[model samples]
Target: MELLIKGGTVVTASGSFEADVAVDGGKIAAIGKNLPVTANQVVDASGRLVLPGALDAHTHMAMPFGGTVSADSYLSGTRAAVCGGVTTIFDYPVQHKGETILGLVNSKKEILERDACCDYAFHCCITDLNGGEILDEMAQAVEEGITSFKCFLVYKKEGMMVDDGTLTRLLLRARELGALINVHAENPDLIDLRTEMYLKEGKTSAWYHYMSRPEFVEAEADKRVVHWASHLETPVYLVHMADKEGLEACIRAKEEGHTVYVETCPQYLEFTCDVYKRPDGRNFVCSPPMKGKESQDALWTALKSGFIDTVATDHCPFQSYEKDWGKDDFTKIPNGCAGVENLYPYMLDAANSGKISFERVVEVCATNVAKIFGCDNKGAIAVGKDADIVIYDKDKDFTISVKNMHSDYDHTIWEGKKLHGYPVQTYLRGKLVYDNGNFVGKPGMGQYVKRSHK
Candidate 1:
């Protein structure tokens, strides 16, 4: 054995038990009670929980939007991910006009290859069909192991919105190619209309940001996506879902046996539209902005009931000054918030507080993401899986502050939030990458993972 972790309660998506794990050649060699293996190194995890490191399936590192780029570069973002017990990240690479799907995806891979601190993959986001040339490249992208794509239903002015005709073509082709389509569901026409009305009425506060994108704006698109995928008989993924009606739409689709997977972010689970009333509410301006308490509670219920498939952080952060761009007008604010480094901690805290089971935590944060997104070797503590793991002390006390964070951003929506449990050590392919508030990993040590169709 190359390394051994002993005496911890190993939790998987299905169950938990006391066991010892042995790693060799960057993979799990064995798992059992008292393995009795000889190794180059050993870790005693007597009172901690040994679990698979999380895979953040949705993130926007170093992305450009609203005239400013996101705060975290690949180096800083992946570093923060590992510190938060996330060993893998799937970032979205946006396509520009005249760019092929593979071209934009490869460009993103080049950057991650040069600067990322942990393993990474990409979800190609096609903003322009390029006269359907990009559509022709979808199969090639999937053949190259990039099996997932994202399209927005809104953002028409940004040239990112895809019409139903394009979406239908993508969905049908995705079905044929065994690829999955991820939708950012929001009704573009309604959003534009509401925004114009709000601005004209002099309601330019952050609260108006939420008001313009109220539950219906998201629900209408959510139900439309469900209807489209169901009618077409293809599997579809809804990203950053945050509304009660949307949840109900998904549930109905599931009951009807349509393949619909939903992913919600930590922001929706932790905050509400009420945050917009605060002085710094502009910092909370994200698409499908956090809804009322009922929606938040409904999301928690859905998570507990196994209705939701994955929990990912739409980890796009802007600096305070950039966020202040929309202090007087919400539309100019960059629509995102930071959560990659806080995703696991918040869920683990909820589990420790008895809100959810530990196994459920692993299911949503690690196992489900791997299964849904085709990360074959990365999601469990079982033998033959990658030795990407976290040793968590459920009783360890920590407060989330930007002062101790590893990302390039200067502020966090999670600041001052305290947690009772946290990942104290994180390993990537059997190597100690993060330990006790410090990153021991080097930039560009990460590899670009080739993912298969789910």
Candidate 2:
């Protein structure tokens, strides 16, 4: 054995146990109560909780939008991820006009391979069907193990949104190729009309951003996506779900046995539309902006009932100055916030505070993500799996602040939040990358992971 972790409570999506884990050659070699094997390194886990490292399936690093790039590069973003016990991140690489799916995916993979501090993968975004020429490339993308594709139902002005015809084509193609289609569901027409109305009335503060994207705007699109998917008999995933009506649509689809998966972010669970009324409200601006308290409550209930499939951060951050562009007009603000680093910790805190079970946290943050995305070797602590793990101290109290975070952003949406538990160390493929608030991983230490259709 090259390394051994002893005396930790091993927590998984299903259950927890006290066990000793053995690792060799970057893979888990054995797991038992008293291993006879000896290792060069033996760490005492003691009272900590050992878990499979979380997988963040939604993130945007070094991504350009709204005329400026996101604050974090692959290196900085993965550093924050490792600190938060996330071992792998799947970033969406958008296909620009005249760009091939392979071109966008390969380019993004090249950057991540060179600069990422932890493992990474891609969900190729298709924005330019280009007379259906791009549809032919979906098979090649799946062959290369990029089995999921993202499409937008909003952002029509940014040239990223696709019409119902485009979405239907992608859904049908994904079903044939054994891939999954992910969507950002929102009524673009309603949003645009409302924004124009708000601006005409001189009600352009950040609060108006939420008002423009009323629950129905998102719910209507959710219904549309679910309807198309059900009629076509294909699986569709709704990302960053934030409204009660939208979730209800998903629930109805699910109860009727339609394959509609829903993902909600921690922001939607913890904060509501009221955040838009703060002095720094512009910082809270994001597309399909946070909804009412009723929506927040619905999210928590869905998470507990297992109606929600996964919880991933749509982590895209811009500098404070960039956010200031929308101080007077919310339409100009960047459409994302930083949450990749805070994702696992916040979920763990919820479990520690008795809001949810630890097993549920593991399921949403790791197991379900891995299973849904076909990460066969991840999301569990078992023999023959990669030694990607996190040692969490459930009794350790911590406070979140931008100064303590490792992301490149100047602010965090989770800033100054308090938590009762946190990850103390993180291992990536048997190597200790983050330990006690320090980053020991090097650039290019991470590798590109080719994901498959589950």
Off by over 4 Å in 1: none
Residue-level lDDT of model 2, residues 59-133, one tens digit each, is 999999998999999999999999999999999999978999988888888888788998988888899898877
lDDT of 1 at 373: 83
lDDT string, candidate 1, 1-454, tens digits: 8999999999999999999999999999999999989999999999999999999999999999999999999999999999999999999989878888887877788888888888998999888888888778988999898999998999999999999988999999899999999999999999889999999999999999999989999999999999999999999999999999999999999999999999998899999999999999999999889999999999999999999999999999999999999999999999899998899989999999999999999999999999888999988998899999999999999999999999999899999999999999999999999999999988887888888885
Q: List the residue pairs that clash in candidate 1.
A: none
lDDT of residue 301 for candidate 2: 97
> Whole-model lDDT for model 2 versus the true structure?
0.92
After the best TM-score superposition of candidate 1, give how far the Cα of residue 356 lies from its true spot, in angstroms.
0.8
Note the Cα lDDT for every prediction shown.
0.93, 0.92
TM-score of each: 0.99, 0.99
TM-score computed on alpha carbons, candidate 2: 0.99
Give the per-residue Cα lDDT of candidate 2 at 284: 89
Candidate 2 residue runs with Cα over 4 Å from true position? none
